[model samples]
Target: MTATDGHGLRADAARNYERIVVAAGQAFEEAGSAVTLEEVARRAGVGVATVYRRFRNREQLIRAVFQHIVAAEIEPAMAVETDDPWRDLVSSLEATVEVLAGRKVVLAIARETRALDLESMRRFVATMDRPLRRAAEAGVVRPELVARDLAAVTIMALATVHPRDPGGADRKRYLALLIDGLRPAPTVLPPPSTPDVHGV
Candidate 1:
């Protein structure tokens, strides 16, 4: 939000901005980028013009909502205190997935639209990189596991929590399986369903 005085937002403008951002954050979390500006404005109890004044376009509003969510939910999880890297890692993963469970569409749009270059997204990746490196170095997980891999695991695990499985039993089972696989223990994995079928 740009300040009219170049120092801080005026009292009313700040409140409007906060309301619109908060409303958009919830909308995106619930409906992702598919949520419209009018819906956001309605949720915020503001006029569409007010939302438009603060966010010039849909892309700008989406990015703002993403930034708000990262700051409110995801960044704080990064501070989860624990002595065990494995527990710390898994706890963070669980917490993150809980947040992302509602925002899959937004995440997909952000990635597929190449918004990875956004400063907020870049900061998220940089913050996650540290924990990923630590988990690998401490042998808490597979050595090759990366932050993006954790994201993939979250997606796969939470995909089961969608409307098709509203009770979330599948989500829980998938998450448990994912956690088991992450442990640094030797175990036999099921054979691939189709091994070299293409034989290319």
Candidate 2:
């Protein structure tokens, strides 16, 4: 998977870039965000100068790794057959959790650094539109449910993936509970509230 930021790179440079990102993803997953550029260079089998030439700083490298994860890991979860909309939605979410569960520290760094690619996020959200709409039409999910809501729920469920629980039982349990909330409810929820950015 190519980084969203990659542009006009020569063939050798692109290969080096891909290697660095792959190495960085593994390093971040294993050792958290504190792993150094030199370490990433060593892991990539590239010189430290090569890493420096590609990414000016740690944040840049982290953002590229984040983008790579989104492309390689998260995006594929949504590519499902449309024969069963509800099943597709659930499978997509479960796949997302499976990809994310082992990389909690990398997730924390992504949030802390705001290393999100909004355009890529938008594309993923768009992929959910058809399944979500079909599920609502079948009355399997609440009509009010939207793609952004699923995105938010996925983020919420990630917190349940404890480092100690290698099996991810708690993550599955909590995510199941959250998914249950998406079903049509007897009582209607109050209108959703938007937090005031100016107040914050």
Candidate 3:
């Protein structure tokens, strides 16, 4: 069966795959989408041939690299306290910025969403959208805000905070501004509608 099958990779292959993804994430962050596969292999302590065997092309490898990083970073961050909807939303956005800043594969995926066939992207948006809408209804976040608007705000915040200066004062300030902007205004929403129990 192919690697795509549920057969599972061999121990050695799994080790090599992990190394390549870690190395590629760092290289991509430092060099952007132009990072070379040769450098990734070199850093991973594996031969270029092995890297190629695992991922036929740069695009494939980049996708794998991003998936790995997101699993490691983003997923875990979301598991923290989310008792307050507004705080949870801000924390999630901050975590995304941290992950994207250090993973150019993520940046590349964002840049070419049309080409990436990534189901995770859709799932992520849906996950965030639910809480965002709830936060708006609860008067925690702006009623006029949509999930896409929040996503745009995150992208803008990341653009303003350079990767090299992650966690610096400027990054903190930008995050604060983003959180502040998301806060609900008293006059923003219309009256709530009652739930429809019967089919129309």
Quick one: best lDDT, which candidate?
Answer: 2
Candidate 1: segments with Cα more than 4 A from true spot = 1-15, 28-35, 105-120, 185-200
Write candidate 1's Cα lDDT for 80-172 as tens digits.
756677777777777777787767766666666554444775555544666667677888776655565566577688777767776667877
* By TM-score: ranked, best first: 2, 1, 3
Q: What is the C-alpha RMSD of each candidate to the true structure, in Å?
A: 6.7, 4.1, 6.9
Sequence-dependent TM-score of model 3: 0.70
Indicate whether candidate 1 or candidate 2 has the larger lDDT.
2
lDDT of each: 0.71, 0.79, 0.68
* Span of 10 residues, lowest total lDDT, candidate 2: 191-200
Q: TM-score of the candidate numbered 1?
A: 0.71
Supply candidate 2's per-residue lDDT for 175.
94
- What lDDT tens digits, residue by residue, belong to model 3 across residues 22-130? 9887887777767788999999999999999998887787667656655777656655555687777778788877666555445665457432434555434444576
**Clash count per candidate:** 0, 0, 0
What shift in Å separates residue 13 of candidate 1 from its native position after superposition? 4.3
TM-score of each: 0.71, 0.83, 0.70
Error of 1 at 184 (Å): 2.9
